[model samples]
Target: MHYLDNLLLNTDSYKASHWLQYPPRTDATFFYVESRGGVYDRTLFFGLQTILKEYLGRPVTHAHVDEARDLFAAHGEPFNEAGWRRVVDRHEGRLPLRIRAVAEGSVVPTHQALVTIESTDPDAFWVPSYIETLLLRLWYPVTVATVSWHARQTLRQFLERTSDDVEAQLPFKLHDFGARGVSSAESAAIGGLSHLVNFLGTDTVAGLLAARAYYHEPMAGFSIPAAEHSTITAWGRDREVDAYRNMLRQFARPGSIVAVVSDSYDIFKAVSEHWGQTLRDEVIESGATVVIRPDSGDPADVVHQCLQRLDEAFGHVVNGKGFKVLNHVRVIQGDGIDPTSLRAILERITSAGYATDNLAFGMGGALLQRLDRDTQKFALKCSAARVDGCWIDVYKEPVTDKGKTSKRGRMTLARNAATGHYRTVPLADEAVSLDVADAPAGYEDAMVTVWENGTLLRDWTLAQVRERAAAERL
Candidate 1:
């Protein structure tokens, strides 16, 4: 068996010794994951289903146990050999854990419980925290999806304000360009797919593959024929016009779109002399929309200049919203783009009387590789534990950092039907009164059991996830 397939060895070294440290007679431990508030007010819950389907759906084998035992023994860490062997022999190597989570693609408020896990068997009390190292990595996809969702909101705002057809243009406004900018192919696949949860345009093939393989989607993203610096500059500076014309001749069919990078020599010269003057008639006569890409200089300024040049050459028509929509031309700014810069460029364009339909954005590093766990302040903490036979709340409240304090007791994510607001509430018990008039009226648990033991209880498709993400948030 491959090392990564060995669940026993796929965690922090400290986890190997945690089984010994739990209080005597501890029966089970409950843990939950949440975003403790950072960057965004809400998070688009995602990627947990992929992780569950990929890692936890398989049963462990004796070979995995033997490998883990040898590795931990040689590495000077205490191994839970007996416990693992018992799991293999008695449970057929299926992990005895129950995982509950908010539905994938739900846009949940920060600082609320998003996922909960607990051991389902008395002998597997240590299983919850043992897998923390792997499970907590959900922070990556969740953060990426949250950022992309917020970007979608920003683009939707601008499109609504400046474009006549907001719905027609909003979904393709932000395109994923982060595949090469990420750390590994796996990171690209996961982060790229997360971005696609909110937008339909992408250049990351790995993300599309991940969506298909993990989420049962045939195709999760779309891309048009586009040019890179190498493809454009390799034509030599003198033949730049030929390069531009070739892109049109090769890919620009009636009603189709093609993008060509125009900054190889001078973006202004390429737009003015080549696209605007020499090939202006061909661009118009082709009956296709030609997308001009400016890959250098200040994004807002360059985009503004490109739009100005394109408008001067091809002209524009006033949309019903009274904003200028360039004729047969558009600009895609792929450089120095993040949420802040993207909004800045849109504001600049809208202020200049240009519709959001005249522009789109392609984000790279900022979309995938730039964030960390603290970007959304994600945390997984022990909330309740079973000691002897009684369940008790467990939490940490450090005086030095009040923000790090975790929740107490077993919790459930409850949503108020009337207000569409969400809050974390303690699971109802004998001591807790949930029927009070002052309590959250019309509140119901929004979390569902997604994984139990080694079985996947619910499977979410990419199309369903996209629909949930596109729904208007209350």
Candidate 2:
């Protein structure tokens, strides 16, 4: 057995003893995962499909049970061997749990339940909470997707105000440069794909492959020929112009775009002297757009200076929006960019009469690695439990931290017809299950059963996810 494939060993150590901690006569438990509100007003739902397909879809084998039992026994934690064996023997090793979530890519307001889980069989009541460690990790990808989505909104706002072509240029404004900045290949695959849900520009190959493997997308993103500081500086300081020329000679073609990092030895001189003066005629006659990448200095000031130099050399035409756009040269600031810095850079350039379309952005650590579960205050808590055939509401309400309070009872995400806003409401009864198609009058249940008894019920395509994410509401 692969070391990481053991579902029993994937959770917190304390979870190994949870089966013995439930209340007496506890026959079932219901739990839900929510963003209790944090940095953003809305959370974009994502990555649950990847988790379900990659992890929960696999069954628990007898070998997995035996390995986990011995490990837990040696680690001084209790292992529920009988419970696991029963699943393997009677239920054919499949987890008897039902999971319902809002459709992937839905922008749900924080504090509403994004996912609900419960064991379908009475004997497997503890299974839901036991897997909370893995399920709640969904917060990572969801937060990354939300961040990317919000960045998209910011870019769209600036583009609409400063550029004539908003729709055509919005998709490629923010590029994902986050693969190496993340913790692992899995993080890159997950967070990278999450960013792709909102943008079409990415340098992370793993993200594109993830979309193909999990979301059934042939090619979810695009990247152009580009150069890094190493490639430029390898030619030595005296040969800097040769390095820039080599890039154009190799990759420049009609109607193509190529980026070359120009900050290795004096960014201003490189952009103003080399790209603007030395190669001025070559850049114009190449018939391809050249993107100058400045990887150092203050993001706003550096980008503004590069744009000014490029406009001086290439000349610019004022569009209908009265913003100056360079002829065949552009600038991409890939350094020191976050939500705050990004806004500042856009403000600086637009205030100088440059259109937002004259620049694009590539974010690395800020896009993928700089976030945590607390960034969005994600939590999965048991909300209801059944004992001796009687259902009781369950929750946590700490007076010291009212923000940490958990919801109670079985809940459903309902959307009002008149307001079109979503709210979490208790089910009519413990046994009631509402479907979106046949919802109660004036309210629609946004939750859909995505997985049941170890089988994937809903598989979303990348295009569908993008469309849902782009919706104004619902």
TM-score, candidate 1, is 0.97
Cα-based TM-score, every candidate: 0.97, 0.98
Top candidate by TM-score:
2
TM-score for candidate 2, residues paired by index: 0.98
Please write out the lDDT profile of model 2 over residues 1-474, one tens digit for every residue: 789999999999999999999899998899999999999989999999999988988889999999999999999999999999998987888899999998898998999999999888888899998999999999999999999999998998899999999999999999999999999999999999999999999999999989998999999999999999899989999999999999999998889999999999899999889999999888888999999999988899999999988888889999889999899999998898898899999999999999998999999999999999999999999999998888899999999999999999988788776776898878645544665555656888888889888889999999999999987532
Candidate 2: segments with Cα more than 4 A from true spot: 430-432, 435-441
Worst 10 residues of 1 by lDDT: 429-438
Question: Which RMSD values do the candidates have, in order?
Answer: 1.9, 1.5
Candidate 1 has an lDDT of 0.91
Tens digits of lDDT, candidate 1, 51-166 = 89788888888989889999989999999999998899988999998898988999998999999998888998999999999999999999999999999999999988988898
lDDT for every model? 0.91, 0.92
**Stretch of 10 with least lDDT, candidate 2:** 428-437
